[model samples]
Target: MTTGRHAGSRAPGSCAQSAPLVLALLLAGCAVGPDYHTPPLSGTEAPQGWHATLPHHGSRMALAHWWEQFHDPVLTQLVEQADATSPTIAQAVGRVREARASVSTNRAALLPQLKGSGSATRQGGFGGSQFAGGAGGLSAGALNPTLGLGTITTLGAQADASWEIDLFGGKRRSLEGADARLTASEADWHDARVSLAAEVANTYLQQRECEALVDIGAATLSSRQETLQLTERKFRAGFVAPADFAQAQATVGDAVNALEGQRAQCAQGIDKLVALTGLDHDALNGLLSKASAQIPAPPDPGVPDVPAQVLSQRPDVSSAERAVAGASADALASYRSKVRQAVQEVEDALVRLDASERRVDAATMADAQYAKVLEASNARYRLGAGSLLQLEDVRRTALQASQSLAAVKLERAQAWVALYKAVGGGWRDDAPNPHPDHKTTAPTAQGRTHTGSAS
Candidate 1:
């Protein structure tokens, strides 16, 4: 009997040990869907080299600090401020947080769940003798503080645990998808920052260009007014015709009109800058006052010889790649289309940037030649060797050339900004791992705060 009793006890222990092993094997079962692999770039997807001209012999530039190349502290500050306060960035951060939470929820589903419960009850009543005796005795017992007979109390507690076996690894696949989405969300956040910084820089550049053009207009107006005064003196002395005097008067009127128009454009540019930087008018004006009105010259952002390297640096491309990885096999084709679009954007920006640089060179040469002609005409006129009409004609040509140069310069700057945005503004896939604590608030421009992921 003793041996049989020991054998029975060991059987229960053996079953208990085997139960955990069985659960672990179930958890390791094959997943239901296909595993993801990155598609290899080939043909049009990857090129040997860029078709567009590479700036600086295809040298690599640190994209993260691309704005610093301008050596403009105000540009850098404005970019930083825009990055901190952009609503688009805030939205991306929210998506990342949601994805992280989903990952946690899915991970927990793979583990055993437990539950505990408890209950208590109490009763009081008269004893058998008191009830059998009569109504009077029962009444007396009810009146008594301690009742006549039985009082009872009961307490109970219980615990339960359950686990839904992942059977075919559905839960694991869900976790995999969640992780991929989290990666995509992070990439999107970086993309937003890159776009916002480029926008702020471009707007600031436009504002400065507007100011420079205003200065040019002022100078041109002053020169035309002096010509008008000279023509008026000549007309009074009967040395010039009424036709000449009328032409001079009209030229001065045109100059005044042009100068006022330039001033209006400069004011409009300021409004755009204010919108982008989230700064009030006074504060924005104060910041603008600190810097001269010259457009900030952007440095060449070197392109990599390998087209694949450049494509990989783009955040939108990275995000698209992650989308492919997260999708079911049936949906992968759609996600790949996004990747192709991203590559196309980079190609387009490269072409524009290369063309803008060449245009700027040509415009610069034209402006210098026009200035020379205007200077010679002024000297001849002052010495009484050239007509006033000839001098005014030269001045008009010079002014047009100057305006063209400024416009081309602005176009070149905008092209650089587009390229910076297309290539992901120097953001890297290997940014430092997100903070472990997951701080939920970040400071914005002007002492304000908003809920967002830490930088």
Candidate 2:
């Protein structure tokens, strides 16, 4: 009977040993949490071309190193400096590193965890009875020969391991979320770089425009001074009234005031450039001195293609799209909102560029007409058929038109800059789409296209 019982006990023990294997197999089939699927990109249904098409619709404009398109070495240098020194870019880089570290941390959860521990201890104790005689625990003076207390020493070490088995796929879901976040952070880093470059370019352009204004003010002042001198001579010789002389002097003063203001504006622009580039004032001055006084023409950026190209090139769009893919319902909705905003920004930039070009054309034509009028006035004044006031008025009108044209040219250039920034500053068309599963569409109809680069 005893032998039979022993054999039965052996079978029970064997079955108990196999229980863990069965449990593992069962857990393997169960995975918790909803599966992730890539979300469809929003606002990508527009046609290949922007609402406003460019003159060169067939050729593609490269936005990578878009600053180089301006052909300004100073602009190129400033962008490089901003990229290397900007704290914004550095912060973005740090975020990417942190996200990567988070991925590593969560990934560890997928594997079994093991820990080791060790300890050492010493203790001593004495029994009262041992120190006393055996006669009903007699007096301590009659101590037993065996009475003694000794310390015990022990050293021990152990290793323990455990695994969650991922019964409900919680760990898997967490890992997926981590991966998505990491991708988003990388996209953000790129976006930061794009934004930084655009800012530097814009600041550099502003400085150029300021210098151009200063030049105009200086020339106008010189012209006014010459006119004042001629008027003064006429007054001294009694050839012109005192009122006319006073008017000429006032005009010169106005010009001088305007020139001073323009110089102040130019200085402010330089200061801003210095701040953006993280360079010393003297160094920036050297770079500015090397650049031409005239505003450099904007590079001929080829026509923008389909909206999908925008999505691929724009880092913000890519990052937002990634967020939608891995985020919860609420967060996904927020990211979707950003997609539409991105599309709107591109459209707005194109419209502004188109409008600015028209203004430039109008200003140029007006300036030419005024020049002709000024010439006719000069001829009449020499023949004594026009009064001095009449000639001066025509000259002022011509000067005003020229100034308007200069300002318009600056605006056109700025419009082009806006377009570049809006279109992701030279993002490649073939850049990988965050949502690769969806097909991208293009615009069908073209209207007043935004063409030409800024100058």
TM-score of each: 0.81, 0.78
Top candidate on TM-score is 1
Runs of candidate 2 with Cα error greater than 4 angstroms are: 1-30, 42-49, 120-155, 372-385, 426-455
lDDT of 1 by residue, 1-455 (tens): 99999999999999999998887787566557667676776656666777777788889857765787889888888887776677787787788788778778977998999998776554557665332332222212232346546645455667899998888878877877776766667666777777788878888888888887888788899988888888889889898899988999999899999889988988887788777778888888888889757787778778777777766766666666666666755546655665566567777878888888888999999999999998898778766688889999999999988888888888888888887777666433333323234432221111111121110
For candidate 2, write residues 1-455 as lDDT tens digits.
Answer: 99999999899789999998988788767776545554666345344556765636625656677778778888888888887788887787677667667767878999999998876655555634333223222222232347665444455677899987787677776766666666667677667777777777777777777787778778777866777777788789898899988988888888889889888988888888888789999999999999645677775556546766664566666566556655678766766666667667777776777777789889989989998998787677555477668867887888889888877777777777777666666333443233333122111111011111100
Error of 1 at 386 (Å): 3.1
**Candidate 1 to truth, TM:** 0.81
Best by lDDT: 1
CA lDDT scores, all candidates in order? 0.73, 0.68
Backbone collisions counted per model: 0, 11
